[model samples]
Target: MTATHHTTVELAKLARVLDRDPGDLAFLATLPPEALREFRDQITDLTARREARRMQRVGAAAKIVPAPIAAKIAEAAFGPVLAAAIAGSVDPARAVAIASALSPVFLADATLTLDPRRAVELIAQVPAPMAAAVARELISRGDYLTMGNLAGSVPDSVLRAALPHASDLDILQVGYYLEETSAADRLLTVVTDRVPGVIRATHNAGEWPKAITLLGLLGPTERSKLANVVAAQDDEVIDGLLTAVEEADAWDTLLPVAAGMNPQSLQRLAQRPAMQNPTLLTKVADLALTQNLWLSLLPLATHLSPTQLHTVAARVATEPDASLTTLIEQAHTENHWPTLLPVALALSTPDRKRLASLPVMHRPEFLTAAIKATATHNLWPAALPLLNNLPTTTHDTLATTINTLTDTEFQAAVQAAVQAAVQAAPAADCTATLIQILLRQDFAPRSRSLTLINEAGNLETLVGTITTRDLALWEGLSDIRTEIPGHLRNLLAAQATRCGRPELADNLTAT
Candidate 1:
C-alpha cells in the first residue's frame, strides 16, 4: 500500500475508536501509519478495560435469565452499548441464543460498539441468516465501520449472503474501514464478478481514492483483475481515475496495479485522452522518477502518442542527474529497452546529449544492450543522434559491440543510417560515429561494411563528414582504399580538396 493511502486507512480506524470524523483528526496524517495504529490499539485496550467489572456483572446476571427475556432486557434496559459490553463475557451458547432473539436494528446498534476481538466466538456461532440481517441493517444505516468489523468475524457463508445486499459504493466504503487485508480479500473473493460494477460505481460516485485503497488490500490475482477492469472501462471512468490520482497525488497507489496489467489493458489505459493531458503526464513522470516506477510507467509510455511521449520526455529532462542515472540503470536492469527507447528518442537534442553523458551510459553492458535494442526496435534514426553524444571514453566499448554484430545486424545498422541520411539532411555526426567504429574493426569485415555503405549511396555523406570534422578519416579510409570504388574515391578527393584539406585530398589520390 502507498504511504498516503495507508495513513488514511489508519486515521479512519483511529477516528472510529474516538467516535470522531476522520477529518477531525486530519492532523494525525502527519504521523506514520505504525504510530497511528499503535495509538488506536492502546486506546481501544483502555476503553475495553474501563467497563470490565460492570460488564462481568451483567454477564453473570444474563446466565440465569432465559434467552428471550435477557434479549428483551438487554435491548430495552441495557441499551446497545451496555449490551455489546456484556456480550463477550456471556456463555457462547447463551450469547448466540440472546443474539438470535434480538432485533437486527438493536444488534446493528450494538455491532458498532462491539470489539471483534472480544466477541469472536459469539460472532462465529450466530446463524448466517441473522448475521446477514444485522449486516443489512448496518448497510441501511451507512455504518460501514460496524459492517467491516462484523465482516472480519463472520463466516464466509454469512458474508456471501450479506454482501449482495450492499451496493457497489457500500462495498468500497466498507473496504476502506477494513482493518485486515485478509478480511478485505475474503469480502472481495465472494464478489469477484461484481468488481466491474464496483469500478464503474466508483467513478460515478467520485470515490476513486477509496476504490484505489480497496485495490491495495486485494491479493495479487484479484488486484490485477481489478486493475484490468479499471483499464477496460470507458473514457469517463479512466478520466476520473486520473483526476483522483492527480488530486491526491496518489500515483504510488495506482502504479503497482498498472505495472501488473496485461499489455493490452495497459495499452488501453495509455490511450485514454486524459493520459495525454500535459500536466497529468508531467506529474506522473516526476513521480516515476522519484519513486523508481519506471518499470511500470515505461511500458505504458511506449503506447503513448508521439506528442505525449515528447511531453513526458520534457519532464524527464528536467529531473536531477542522479535521478536520471537511476532511470537508466533501472531500464538496463529490467531489460526495458523496448519500452524506454522511444521516450529517450523523444527528448530534444540537448537533453538527449545530457542523458547520453550519464556515467551509466558509459558502461559496456549498457551500451551493448542499447545497440542491440536500437536494432531490434528499428530505432537507428533516434539512436544515432544519442550515440553521437556518448563520451569519447566509451567509444571503444561501443565499437567492440558494434564489431560483434551478426552480418544481418551489422548491415541493418548500415542500411538504417543510409536510409536516415537519404530521408533528411546529411547526418554528419552519424556518419562520423559509424566511421569511428569501422576504423576500430578488422579490415575484412570493415571493407565488406564499407562496400555495403557505398552500394547504399552513402559515400557522399561519409566524405562530407570526413572533410568537415576529422581529416584523419581520409587517412583511415586510405588503408582500405582498394575497397573504395574509383568513382567514390574521386568524390572523396574532390570534397577533401574543396574543404581546404589538400593533404587529405592527396592521401585519397595517392591510394
Candidate 2:
C-alpha cells in the first residue's frame, strides 16, 4: 500500500512513539509523492482508527500486569499506546470489546499493523473472561507467540486454520499449553496437523516450559517438527528440547535434546536407556540438578523436595510401580549425590532426613550451605524439623559435632526450637523422628519432651510412635495393656506395612 499525503507526519508520530531512530523512520517513510498520498489514505482508513481503539482497549486491560510486562506490550504494539491505554481505568469488559472490534482490521490490512510481542503481552494480560476475544485476535495475526498464547482460548476452527500455517516451532509453543492446560484433545489434534520432524529451533523470547510440555504431547507428525527445531539450536536449549523428548520412549527419531538435562532429570529420563542410547542422559540430569537449573524443575519438572523425596521415596516409586532405591543405586554408578542431595534436602522430606543422617564427611558444602542458609535466613524452623527426623545414630553425632555447647547452652537452643515448634502446626515426621530418638535415648526427658509428639500436627505418626513403644511408662496406662497393646500392636504393624516395611510389620491377629 502506498503512503498518502500525510504519510511523513503520521510516520514521524509513529516513529517517535515506536522510539526508533528518527533517520530510520524518515528513510522508511521516504516514498514517491503519489505513493505517499496512497499510504496516508491507507493509514487514515476508518479501519485504522477502529483498530487503534481495539489495540488501545487491550492496552487498557493490561494495567494489571507489572510495569515491565506492560512495557513489553508497548513495544509489541508497533507504537500503539499499550501502557497508557491499560492505565486508563476503563472497565475491563469495555476494553476487550473495543479491542476485538479492531483486531480483524489490523489483521486483514498488512499495512495496518500490530506487534506480535505487544499483541501477546496484551493477550496475556486480558482477563480470563475476555480470553476468547484475545484468542480470536491472536488467530487473525498468525504469529507463533500469538498462536501459542491464544491456544487455550481460541475456538477450534481458528486453531485448525492455524495448525497448517504453523511451523514446528509454533506447534511446540502452542502445543505446550495444549499439553499443560491438559487439553489432550487439542494436543492430539495439533499432532495431526504437524508435518513430520521435531525441529529444535530457538523459540522467540518468553519462558519455554509450556512449549517444552507441548513437545512431549506430540505424536509422530509433530515430532518431525521437533527434530527440525532440535537441528537448529546451540546446546543450551538441548535441556528444554531433551526435556520434551524425555516424556515418551518412542525414539523413531534420534534424540538430540537429551544431551542438555541435569543429571537427576537426565537420570530419570534415561530409564528407557534403549531409546536415548547416548549413555549420557543421566549425567546431564545430574549436572543440571546441581546447577541453579535444578530449581527450575521444581516448578516445571516436579515439586520433589529432599525430605519429600525421602519420606515418599518408596511410595513415589511404588505408586508408579517404579522403585526409587533401585534407580538411586543404578544412578550412583554415574551420578554424584552432591547435586541430588542438597536440592532434595532443601525441597524433599526424605532427602532432608537423609542429609541430616549423613556422616559429616560424606556431606558436601551444598548440604552445609543449605542448612546454614536456613539458619541465616531466620528459617531455623526448616532446619529444626529435620533435627526431629534425625536418626538416633545421627542425633548423637550432630550433638557432638555441633559447637561444644554446655547443657545450659543446649537447653537454650531447645527452648528456641520449642518456641518455633509451637508456632508451627506440628508434623508427624517430626514426631516420629523425635520418637525414634526417644526410644534410643530413654530418660525423663528435659527440654525435648515426649509430649511434644502430641503437639506435632500428624496424628498417625504420633499414634504409630506411641503404639510401637511399650506405653507402660505413661500414667494410667497399665490396665488397658491387654486391650490396647493388642490393638496398638496390630495397628502399628499394619501402618508400618503401609509405609513399605512388611517384615517389620506386626502380624495383626485380630487383636
Candidate 3:
C-alpha cells in the first residue's frame, strides 16, 4: 500500500482501538507522495522508539531493587506512577510478590494508571477488596476496555467484589468486548445475585440490543439463569427490550437468548401484549421453527391469546412434517394438547390427514388424551376440522379410542361439539362438523347420535351436502342409532321425491 493509504489505515485502526470517531479524510489522497512517505516514516519511528523506551523502563525497574524494598520505595517515590511502572515492567511472579508487599490503598491507586494489558496479568494477586475498589475506579473513569481485558483472567471472588462497582453501561461495554466470553459468563454466574441490578443498568443505558447480543454468548444453562433475571424486570423493561430489538432489526441477536429462556420465562414473554401483534408473532413463529425451538416454544403456545395461538399454530402446521411432528410431540408431552388442537385445525386438509395418520398421533394414549383435552377445554371447534379431515384408517383408530371413553367422557365430547356449534361465531361450518363427528359410522355411539340429531339445528343441509360416497356414510349410522335410520328414511324419501329418484328413495329403507 502507498504511504498515505497505510497511514490512513493505521490511523483508522488507532481510532477504533481508542473508541474515537475516524471521520471522512478523503483529503489524504491529495497529500504529495514524498511528503506522505516522510510523515509515515516519522510516525512509525516515533511509535517504535516509544515502545522501545517502555520495554527498557520495564527492564530497568525490575533490576532496581529487591521486591520488598522496591515496593516501599516505589510507594514513597512516584506513588501510583512508580507502582504503575512496576505493574507494567516486572515479570508476573515478581510483580505478584511486590503487590503482596504493597498496601491495598497503593494497589488501588496504581490500578487507575496501570495499562490494562499489564494489569490483567497481575490482577489475581490483588486482594478482593482492592480489586473491587479498582473496578469502581474503572467504572468511574468509564474504562471498559481495561475491564474487558481483565475480565477473563480475574477470579470469580474478585469479579464478584468488583461487579458492584459497575454501572449498566460498564456491564454492557465490558460484556461487549470481553476477550474470553466463558470467563465473562463465569463472572456473571458469580454475581447472579446482582443480576437485577445489572439488568437495570443495562436498561438505563438503553443498550438493550447490545445486552441481548452479549447474552447470546453464554451456554444454554447460563442463558437460562439470565433469562430468569430478564423476566424479573418490570413490564416496561421487557417491553423496551423487545421494542429495541424491533427498532434495531436485531432479531438474530435475540434468538439464542430466547431459545435458552426457561419455560416460565418463556410463558411470561409469550403472554406480553407485544406478543399479540400478528406481525411480531409471525416473526417469532418463523424463528422458532427455523431454529427448532419447538421444545421451548410449544409450552408458551398454551399462554397465547386464542388469536395469537391460532396464528402461531397456522405457521407450525405449514412447516415440514418433521418440524410439525416435533411440535405435536412436545405439546402432547407438556399436556398442551388443548393448545395443539388449534394448530392442528389450521393445517391444510392433506397435512391434517397426514398428522392424524402419523403413528404417534394414532397412539391410543394420544387419541384419548386429545379427545379429553378437546372436551375439557371446549376445543371441539378447533378439533372438528381435523376430525373431518382424518383418513379412513385414522378414523377407525380414533373411533376405537372414542368408544373406550366412559359414558361421561363420551357425553362431554359430544356436548363439547354441541356447545361449540351453538357458540360458533359463524355457525355454518362447525355445526356441520358436529354432525360429521357424531354420525361418522366408525365412531358413533347410538345414544349421543340420537341427542345430536334432535338438538343440532338441521340435518337437511348436512345430509344434502354429502357427496355420493358419503351417502353410504349416512346409511352406515342407521344401525348404530335406531333414530338415525328413521331420520335418514324421511330425509332420503323427501330428497328422492324432490329430485324424482323414487328408486333411490325406496332403497334408503332397505338398510
Candidate 4:
C-alpha cells in the first residue's frame, strides 16, 4: 500500500478518457517509470480505436439502407434477427424514422430478437402506442425478463396501456427488478386500480421483499391503498409479512409505511411481537425524529413497554423545540394523554423544562391533564418542578383546582406537592405559590396542616405579598391565625393597612 507519485502530465489524459482514478490503476503502481509512459499510450490508442469502429458501423448502416425502404429490405433479407442487428447499429434518430413506418407488431417481434442493451436505446425511439403494443405482446408470452429490461426505458403512456394486460404477479416480479425506480414508480400510478390484487399476488408469491420494495416506491395515497390491503389480511398473514421483512433486514423499507399508518392500523402493527425488539424500536425512533413523525408515532408508542417507551422519549427529546411543542399540542388536542405523559415523564430535565414552557401548557385542559398524569404515574417528584415553573397566573389557577379534586386525588396532589417542595428545597417558589393558593381556599384538613404548619413561613410571606396587591387575600387570613408567627402577623397588619384595609389590619393585629 505504499504511495506512488506521478507528474500532473502523466495522468491528465488517461483520467479524462477513462474517467477513472489514476491511483486505481494498481498495475501501473509497480511498473518502472518507462513502462508507465508506454502503458498510457497503449490504453489511449485502444479507447480511440474502439470509439472509431462504433461510429463507422453507424455510418455504414446509414448508407446501406435508404430511410424509405429500410423496413421492407430489413424484413425481406435480414428477417427479425438480422433486422434487429441492423437497427441496433444505426443512429437512434435514423432508427426512429424507419421505425415509424414499420408495423407496430413487426417492430414488437423484432425487438424480441434485439440485444437487451440495444433494445433499451431503440425502445425509446418507438411511439408510445407501438411500445404499448410491444409490451402487451411481451406480457402475453410471460416474457417478464424482457419486460423488466424495458421497464426503466418505456414511456408512461405505453406502460399505462400495457400494464393492465399483465397479471398482478408478473407486474410485481417485473417492477421489482426495474432498472430505474422512478420509472417503476410512475408505472405504479397506472396500476393504482390493481394494487389490492397486486399486493395479494405478491404476498402469495412469498416475495415479501419485492412487495415491500414496491411499497416503498409508492406515493402516500398509493402506499395507503397497499397498506389497507395489508391491514385487511388475517393476523397470521400480517405476522408472516413482518417476519419476512425482518428476516430480509427490510425495516428500512417497511418503516415509512408504519410511520404513515392510520391509528387503528398502527395499533395493529404495534401489537405484533416483532415490533418489541429494542433494536428495531430504536431504529423506528430514529426514523420518527429525523422524519418529524412524532405525532404519528406517539399513538403507536402507547403500545410499547416502559423500557421501550424510554427509548422513544430519549430519542424524541433531542428533536427541535418546535417539533416537541407540536407533538405535545397534537397529543393534547387528540386526547392522547396516556401516550403523552409517559414520554414527557421520560424526558431529560432540560427537555422537560422546555416542554413546561410551551404556550400550550397555559390551556386549562392541558394543565389539568398534566397534573392528573403526575398522580396517575406517581411522577409527583418529577412533575412538581414542571408545574412550579408556569406563569404566576397558572399557579393561581392550579390553587383553585385543588379544592375541586376528589378527596383521593387531592391527597395524591398533596403528597406530590410535598415531595416537590422537599425536592425543590431552598428555592421552593412553586411550592410556596401552590401552598399560598390552596391556603387561600377551603382545602381538605391534611393539605391545610401541611401548608400552614410545616411551610408557615412561605404561606406568611406569600399572604403579606398577596394582601399588599389585593385586600381580597386578607379575606381568609384569620383561618390560619395559630400558624402565623408574631413578626409575620405584624408584617401582614401593616401591609393590609397600606392597601386601604384598616379594618382588616385591626383584625390581623388582634389575632
Candidate 5:
C-alpha cells in the first residue's frame, strides 16, 4: 500500500477518537452537532476490519500468493473483518480455528467494544487466551441488559471452567454481570456461594434499588446475617428494605429489620393494617406495660381505671416511695389530673370520676378520650364547663377528642359552635401544625396533648385553624375521591393515570 493511504487510515482513526468528521477540510467548519455524533458512532469499532486482515493472511498461507503479500495482514491488533465474518459462519470447526489464530489480537485490542450476544456466541469458539480477553472486554463495557440472558445461555460447566482463567482478576467481572442481570440479592451468595467475582458484582449492585428487586433472593434471614455491617452501610441496606417495603410490603421482608434500630422502624409493620392510621406509640406503651416488673407503671398509675388501674397499680403497687393506698388516695383528690389522664388513656382507661372532675383546662382532653371510647352522657356533661374556657390549643386538641365523643356530645359541641371554636385559635400560630395534623386525620389536641409549636407567636401570627383545616380537608377529599362508587373502587385512578403512575392509578380502580 502507498504511504499516503497509510497516513489517511491513521488520520481516520484519530478523527474517530476525537469525534470529528473524517477529513474534508472544506466542509469541516460546517459540520452540525448531529453530523459530528454520526461520524463518531460510525467509526467506533475497528474489529471487523482487523479480523478480515487476519483471515486474508491465513488464506494466503494456503495459496500460491507470496508471503510478503499476505504479511500486510499481520500488522493489525485483531483479526481482519474477513476472518471474523468467516469464523462467525456456520462451519463450527472453521470458526474455532479462525478464533484460535486471532486470540493474540483480542488480547492486544483489549478495549474493543463488543456486541453482548455475539461475544457470548463467539467466545466459546475462541482459543482460551482470546476468550479470556473477549470476556474481560464484555464484562467491563458490554450492555448490562445482556448479563443474565448471556449467563444462562452458556452451559454453566463451560462457563465455570472458563471462569478461573477469565480476565476477571478481581470481582468486577461478576459485578458487571450481576448488574446486567439485575440481581443484586445474589451478592451475599456470590460472596459465600464460592464465586469470587460473582459476589463483588452482587455487593456493588446491592446499593442500587432496582437491582435488589430483580435479585428477588434476599430475605429476612440474609438481612439479619448482615446486621453487623457498618452503620452507614447498614443504613444503605435499610434504604433497600424501604424500597422493598414500598414495593411489596411482604411479611418475610418486614420481620428481619429489628436488628437495626432505625428512626423509621415501626414494629408490627405487617401489611399496612386494615386502618390507614395506626397509633405508633401504642407499641412503646406495650414495651413499658409488660408485666415482668411490678413498678413499671408506678409513675403514672393514678390515671388508669378500676381494671386497668388495678393491673398497672399492682405493678407499681410495690414502689418503696409510695403505698398503693397513697397512690389511690392522690388519684382520688385529682391533684395530678392532667398527667394521670394521659397515662390512663395510654393504658386504655381513665379514672372515670377523676377524669370527669379534671380542671376546666383539662376537661376536653379526658372527655374527648372518653367520648372516643364510646362513653356516654357523663363524659359530655363533664366537658361542658370547659366549652368557654377552651383555648385555641385546647380547641385543636378537641378537634380530635371531639371525634371520639358520642354523637350526642359531638352534636352539643357542634351546636356550641365548633366552627367558632376553630376560628378562635390564632390563624398563623396553629395553621401549619393543624394542616399537618389534619392531613394525618388526628382530630384531638387538648391543652395537655399540644406542644404549642410557638409560644411567642402573636395574635397576628396565629393562623385561623378553620381555614387551614378546610384547605387540608378539601385537598384530601380531592385525592380520596368516590366519583364512581360501588364496583368502581378508586376515585384517584383517573388522576394517577393522567400523571403516568398507572400502578397507583390502577389501585384507584375496581377490577
Candidate 6:
C-alpha cells in the first residue's frame, strides 16, 4: 500500500476502537501503521476486558430463553452494540442458532459492532448461506469494514457464495479495509479470475492506491498475475494507473510487480505511450536511484524509443556522483551494461563526462565488465562516447581489456570508432579518445590496428587530435608507417601540413 493509504486504514481501525470519527483521529495519521495498530489493539483489548462481566451475565440469560425469543429480545431490547458485546460469551452452538433466527439486516447491523477476534468460534459456526446473506446486506449498506472484519473468520464456502454478489469495486474496497493480509490473499484466491475486472474497476474509479495496496498483500504468484492483468489493459487505463501511482508516490509498491511480470507483459507495459511521459520518467528514475531498482528498471527502459530513453538519460545525468557510482556498480553486478550503455551514450557531452569520471569507472573489474558487455552486445557504437570520457587513470585497464578482444571484437570497435568520427562534428572527441588510448597501450597486432585506422578514411580528425592533445601520437603512426597505404599516407601528410605541423607530417612521409 502507499504510505498514505496505509496510514488511513490504520486510523480508521483506531477510530472504530475509540468510538471516534476517523476525521477526529486524523492527527494520528503521521504515525507508522504498526504503532497505530498497536494502540488500536490495546484499546480494543481493554474495552472488551472491562465489559466481560456484564456481557457474561447477558450471555447466561440468552441461553435460558429459546433461540427465536432470544433473537427478538436482543434486537428489540439490547440493540446491535450490546448484542455484539454479549456474543463471545454465549455457547458457540447457541450463538449460531440465535444468529440463524435473526433477520439478515439485524445480523448485518450486529456485525458492524462485533469484534471478530472475540467471536471467532461463533462466526465460524454460522451457516454459509446465512453468512452470504449478511455479506449481501453489508455490501448494500457499503459497510466494508464490517465485512472485512468477518471475511477471514468465515469459511471459504461462505466467501465463495458471498463474493459473487459483490462487484469488482466492492471487492477492492473490502480488500483495502481487510485487517489481515492472509484474509486478503484468501479473498484474492477465491476471486483470481476477477483480477482484470478489478483492475479496470480500480482505474475507472481512480482507486489505484487501493489496487496497489491489494497487490502488495498477495504472494508473488498472485501479484505477478494481477500485474500482468493490469499490463494487458489499453493505454488509457494503463496511463490512469501510472497517474494514480505518481500522485500517491507509490512506485515502491508498483515497481516490484512491474519487475516480476512475465517478459511479454513487462515489454507491453514498458512500451505503453504513458511510459514516455518525461515527468513520470524523471520521477521513476529518481526512485530507481534511491531504491536500488535499476536492475528491475533497466530491462523495461530498453523498450523505450530513442527520444524517450534520452529523457530518462537527462534525468539520470542530474544525479550526484555517488549516486552515479551506485548506478554503475549495479549495472556491472547485474550485467546490465547493455541496457545502461545506451543511456550513457544519450547523455549530453558534459553529463557523459560526469558519468565517465565516476571513481567506480576507474576500477579494473568495472572497466572489464563494461568492455565485455560492449563486445557481447555489439554495443561499441553506443559505448564509444562514454569510453571517450573515461579518466586517463582508467586508460591502461581499458586498453588491456580492449586488446584482449578477439579479432572480430577488435575490428567492431575500430569500425564503431571510425563511424563515430565520420558521423560526429569536426572535433570527433569519441574517436580521438579511442585512438589516444590505443596509442598508449602495448597493443598487439599493432600493424593490423594501424591498418584499420588508415583504411577507415578518418585521418583528418585523428591527425587534429594528435596535434592538439598529444603530438607524440604522430611518432606512433611514424613507427607503423609501413601499415599506412601510400595514398592514405599522402592524405594524412597533407592534412598535417594544413594544420601547420610540417615536422609531424615529415614522420608519416619519411618512412
In Å, residue 321's CA in model 2 sits off its true spot by 34
Residues 60-140, model 1: lDDT tens digits: 999999999999999889998889889999988899899888999998888877888888888778887887898898899
Can you write out model 2's per-residue Cα lDDT over 1-511, one digit (the tens) per residue?
1122124334543443355554676765656544643453454455345666774666555656554454444446633343333323334354344444344334223212333223444434454434434344554565333344346544455455545544555555455433123343455555553433323333334334444444444444544444444444544454554544344321212232333334444444433322243333333334333332332222212223333333322322222213333333333433333233333334355545554444542233333443334434344444555566554556444433333333343333344454544454333235344334334332334223333432334334335433334322222222222333344445555665666655445333323
TM-scores for every predicted model: 0.79, 0.27, 0.61, 0.50, 0.28, 0.74
Q: What is the lDDT of candidate 2?
A: 0.40
What is residue 270's positional error in candidate 5, in angstroms?
7.8
The segments of candidate 5 whose C-alpha lies over 4 angstroms from its true place after superposition are 1-86, 103-122, 127-130, 136-153, 162-206, 213-511
Between candidates 1 and 2, the TM-score winner: 1
Per-candidate clashes come to 0, 71, 0, 0, 33, 0
lDDT of each: 0.80, 0.40, 0.64, 0.63, 0.36, 0.80
lDDT for 173 in candidate 3 is 74
lDDT of 6 by residue, 1-511 (tens): 4667778888987787677899999888789987888888888789899999998999999999999999999899998888888899999999989888899998888887788889888877888899889999999999887787788787788899899989999999999887766887788888988978988888888888888877777766777778888888887888888777777788877777786787778778777766768888888888887787777678767666778778888888888898788888878887888888888877888888888777888889988998999998788888877887887788788878877777778777766766665676322566656765776666455555656666554555454443434576567667767666676678767867887889878988884
**Collision count of model 3:** 0
- The 10 consecutive residues of candidate 2 with the worst lDDT sum are 472-481
Q: What's the distance in Å from true for residue 64, model 6? A: 9.5
Q: Candidate 4: lDDT over CA atoms? A: 0.63
**TM-score of structure candidate 5:** 0.28
**Looking at model 5, which ten-residue stretch has the lowest summed lDDT?**
267-276
Across 223-322, the per-residue lDDT of candidate 4 in tens digits comes to: 6656766876778768878888777666555666665667677768877777777787777788666655655566677666667777777787777877
